[model samples]
Target: MKPGEFAGKTAVITGAGRGIGEALAKTLCREGMHVVAGDIKKESVERWKESFPEQEILAVSCDVTKAEDCEALVQTALDRFGQLDYVISNAGILHSGAVDEIDPAVWKQVIEVNLYGTFHMIRAAAPVMKAQRHGVIVSMNSKSGKKGSYKSSAYAASKFGALGLVQSAALELAEYQVRVNAICPGNLMDSPLWTEGENALGIQYARNRGITTEECRAMYDRQVPLGRTCRYEDISNVLLFLLSDDSGYITGQALNVTGGFEMR
Candidate 1:
């Protein structure tokens, strides 16, 4: 599609500091949409502002886990652009722990950030979208959400919660012409949720499989039929469609952007 399909549209994307979120923001901006990008990291927010100074993009500091922050994010979008056309709840975190070994604290953190975070964004954005009588919402999910994983108790649970939220919101928002859907990506190479923090999980995965850390990483990639990890654009392309008129009839569905990894 040519750029500017969203020329007069305004959008808000949470957890847009880096990776897939960043990719989505850039794609929307390139498409001529006014974008408000939110992230928990101050540095990342500032960096985005500097990187795309020419685009109609605003970078805001926000913690998706907090209701107040979510409200503020919506307000910022409306205040700056006058209306919200698209809302993407892309903020999330991952915690790798076996069902028996996972700590409650870690489990709660995942739920708070992934599940509750998506709820807060949707709850706040829906009213504005309904009032306007036209809007699109896309939530970031995972292949794990559709299937089980070896050490993804918290992550999977959070994503499953997202599916429920999408369905409920779709039913309620239909009359207002606000469509809600989800994008489930698999094995992205550079998502902080997967590659950052908690080195212990990788070590544990290797130990469980009786292999090296390198082998564990390799094993994960080998499972993908594409024979390589996905880049953020691989997921962004699907998201762009879901947000555009191309997906006008799609709602309450979690489209898989996995590299043939999770066949339904």
Candidate 2:
């Protein structure tokens, strides 16, 4: 799409406090779209609000796992921007553990945040998009959603369910001119999701494999044909296309942005 096509548009993005969500919000705002940046952490949201002009972004403390919070996010977009033109369901958590060894509670938490969270966002945004008879929805899926991963049952399962949800939602919302799709990104090594701390996937995977996080990162980098890990801009570019008028004919599909790491 042209640079100005997104100007004056409004988008609601969950998990927008950091990582890929933050990247997307920044990119969209730079392109002139008003953004509602929602995150579970109040401080993160405040940071985002302070980063941009008040007219360009609205940062809200939101937990996508809660239906009410999801509703409030969309309402904030409408109240502040006067319309909601796009929804990006980027809120998710990662857990790496063998199916047999992982606690059921952990599995439940992953599903609750990743799968149910996507559902809540969609549930709240669908009516608004349908009423307007125009909108786009993009969910941040993962390569694991399309293929099996070592010691990633919980994360994979949640992403798999999320993809299915996007497919069904696409079919249901097609008549309303609201397109729903997903972007399955490869490893984003620089993101907090991988580099944060003990809870980070890289650290967890390294522990499970009896290796160093750096070693694990190198292994993944080699797996990608591009010889590098995914950057926030890589996913953001694809998301921009999916949400723009350029991809108006696309829907009910999960596009891969994995540097050819996954091809089926």
Candidate 3:
């Protein structure tokens, strides 16, 4: 992005506590945007407050599953910055298990956090953007959104629904100049989302595929034509474009950053 292009602009980002959300928050902050970073975890948001004192970032406690909390997140941004330039719906969750093995509640939880959460934020922010007649909203989607995930049916379903929401919302908000789009990123093997915890996705995938974690990780790497896992910078570069006037004519697109792992 050009220097000062997003300077002085205000953005509200969900799931800002860790992983891709945290990475995106750092990128926007470095670009001189006022960031209202939120997460369901209060401690995570507090950590953000302590970590980025020099930057114009406001940490908020937001649970995307709750409509009221989503509204409050937007309200806080408007109250503090007075205008919302961007909304990044990056908060999401996933679980991997066979169709019959996974509990119904767990499946619903994924939908709630990944799909309903996106709706809540868009619903909350749409009016504000409409009133202003300008704004951009980007949802952190996944390549699973384009195809099914191995042993992760719930996650794929949620992302599929989110892409649908992005398209429908884009059409509805187009007259107001409020763009809605999604980023369908490939597997981010190095991200904490897949690498952390004993029950990390890498481990789960390996178990499901009857292989070792390293083998499972290597298998995915080979699937990508680029021969590498997705990177935070890859998504950020596309994000910067989506948030900039360079992509002003684009909306409702679920851009695939999959390195040819998925194509339709």
- Candidate with top lDDT is 3
If scored against the real structure, what TM-score would every candidate get? 0.92, 0.96, 0.96
Cα lDDT tens digits, model 1, 1-264, are 455687878989998888788888888887788989999984686686676778767888899999999999999988988999999999988768789999999999999999999999999998999999999999999887898776788999899988999999999998998999998988775455456655655566677789986887888889898887778788778888888888888899998877798876
Give the least accurate 10-residue stretch of model 3, judged by summed lDDT: 42-51
lDDT of 3 at 179: 98
Cand. 2 TM to true fold = 0.96
Candidate 3 C-alpha error for residue 240, in Å: 0.7
Q: Rate the local accuracy (lDDT) of all candidates.
A: 0.86, 0.91, 0.92
Off by over 4 Å in 2: none
Superposing all C-alpha atoms, what RMSD in Å does each candidate have to the true structure? 2.0, 1.3, 1.2
Candidate 2 lDDT over residue span 34-72, tens digit each: 888899985786676666664567778899889999999
Rank order by lDDT, top first?
3, 2, 1
- Give me candidate 1's TM-score against the actual structure: 0.92
Candidate 2 residue pairs in clash (backbone atoms < 3 Å) = none
Evaluated at residue 210, the lDDT of candidate 2 is 97
Clashes of each: 0, 0, 0
